[model samples]
Target: MTATATEASPTDSYHGFLESLEEADEYAAIDTALGLIDAGVPAERVLLDLIAPAQVEVGERWARNEWSVAQEHAATHISERVVAAVAARAVPRPTRGRVVVACMDGEWHALPPRLVAEVLRLRGWQVTFLGASVPAAHLVSYLHRHDAHAVALACALPMRLPHAHRMIEACRRSDVPVVVGGRGFGHDGRWAHRLGVAWAPDAPAAADLVADERALRRVRPAELSQLADDEYASLAKRRGELIDGALADLRARAPGVREYTTAQLDSTVSDLGHIVDFLAAAVYVDDGSLFIDFVRWLIGILASRGVPASAVGLTLGYYVDELRDFPRAARFLGEASASAAAGTGPRAG
Candidate 1:
């Protein structure tokens, strides 16, 4: 029995799986779906029908900010449980194959690749999930040690694509297939073909392609680096638009300063302070002089009259403390700032 072989008594249906998301009973939905898979549902149906719909709900909820991280985590945990439960019951075929799944180094989103592994496992393939942010060297060493038949890489951030590309090349010398998937693929489906390797639009699509034996064996010629000039341009343009819109909104709200009230200003100041801290940590200073000026302006605004520098510094300290847990240089400054903000009110400059 090959990995791609069809089931004897397929249990789950497409419509039935779609309905489960509407039900929103995470555990029950996943558990029931796994029950069907355990009873011999087709691997394709399990992915396209059951898992995909549920994930769409999760993604939509996340986009609207309607769900907490804990809520999202709960859904994902349930889904993982379902996948593992079903996989446990899968009878491995005579020639069970192997796949390596990993997030590119510096990328933290793990659900995509983890789900992909579960899908492949259902098809009777073995999987090695390296989880998130694994360094390039470690991944290459693991590939050599495991001699995986295929590598599945996921990246949620476009900035990590270069690292992903590097990892793809690492697997090339071994003749192992690479499947790149996730939010980072961007607007161009052509980027997939251009990668000079197979790319799945999502987990289900990738599994379907791999399940087809003919598609698995063919290797296309390597085109120029997938990290092209235009791809970076697209990402940069989008990022700039977001920043511009945010700054414009801030300017619009600036005139109604009194409307902020005490609580509202507190909230606004708190959020802006955190954002500045986050940007400072994540963005590269060498990117350009504009970004450097922008950061400076941001700090100045938060510290300007009608806003308290202590509160700003204190909030910044909170974020810094998160990254550096012990012996923080900012602790004393943060304490002083908090004391000043409380004594004079956050409205004082």
Candidate 2:
């Protein structure tokens, strides 16, 4: 039976919506959203308050190990459907200039930006949502062809900030103003400032920023003078070699790894690469806290999966030793390693 929103409180509706996602019931989730709309709830509210928070919870559940990756994907897909249902029920005619929304290169999380796109549409802007992992050149070409008034770029992971910087510059070169948001920019958008791009905390802010041409284009000059040292560049070039060395070090230190399954080995390699990528981003932005925060996040993630925090500490130690010649990279690693050892790493936002 289809659920109705006859007397459902906002809290009840949100919980039920999450329940539907947990069950992978697309119809039920859509019904919950539509029901809210029928109950005089604004479609935009349903999109932001209802669908958006539910997706965030879905990610938290996966992070906590309470939900598997497959479960998270299913929940995200259902949320996408709910967003579509709400949009379909209340399609607004675009009354403003065209806005292009896209994910940075290598950023695969499209749902957050999709919410921004729908909200922009609700507010009467012509929004073009280019989904996940859009390459820089292709995006620039699209912007040139469309004559967009502004572009909103998203980066979900801090490790992708280097690529995000490149893409932001690419858009600016074409004379299209850029506004970026997401956890990648730091919860407070500090990293966005480092990259020298305008930022919005969420969809509504993005909409407001997009509508104002001056604010969107009033970004400060990028503070990447630290890149002059060539540390970030050298670290990126040695990515594969670093991962290999870390793996060899891990195998020697942890004999249990020698008997691990293929999946376990693959995950280890990915983690090592993540450490290097995130370190390079920190070096690029000249921030040690970025790497420290990532270490905290990595510790929690690995802890939830039964890996010890000491494993991360070991890896950081290895990187510090190997990159000792690169002053910036070495300092960042040393600081993070100390934090990880002292259990003082700041929580990821």
After superposing candidate 2 on the true structure, give the runs of residues whose Cα lies further than 4 Å from its correct spot. Answer: 1-9, 343-348
Residue pairs with backbone overlap in model 2: none
Q: For residues 1-349, could you state the per-residue lDDT of candidate 2 as single tens digits?
A: 2344445445668998899999999999999898888887778888888898999999989989999999999899888888888889998899999999899999999999999999999999998999999999999999889989889999999999999999999999999899999999999999999999999999999988988888887879999998987888889999999999999999999899899899999999999999999999999999988888899888888888898788899999999889989998898888788777876533749
TM-scores, in order shown?
Answer: 0.56, 0.96
Q: Which ten residues in a row have the lowest lDDT in candidate 2?
A: 1-10
Q: lDDT for model 1, on a 0 to 1 scale?
A: 0.56
As a whole number from 0 to 100, the lDDT of residue 67 in candidate 1 is 67
Candidate 1 lDDT over 92-159, as tens digits, reads: 66256778888888888776687787777766777778899889888888878886777888876544
In TM-score terms, which candidate is top? 2
Model 1 segments beyond 4 Å from truth?
1-27, 38-40, 202-205, 208-349
Total backbone collisions, model 1: 0
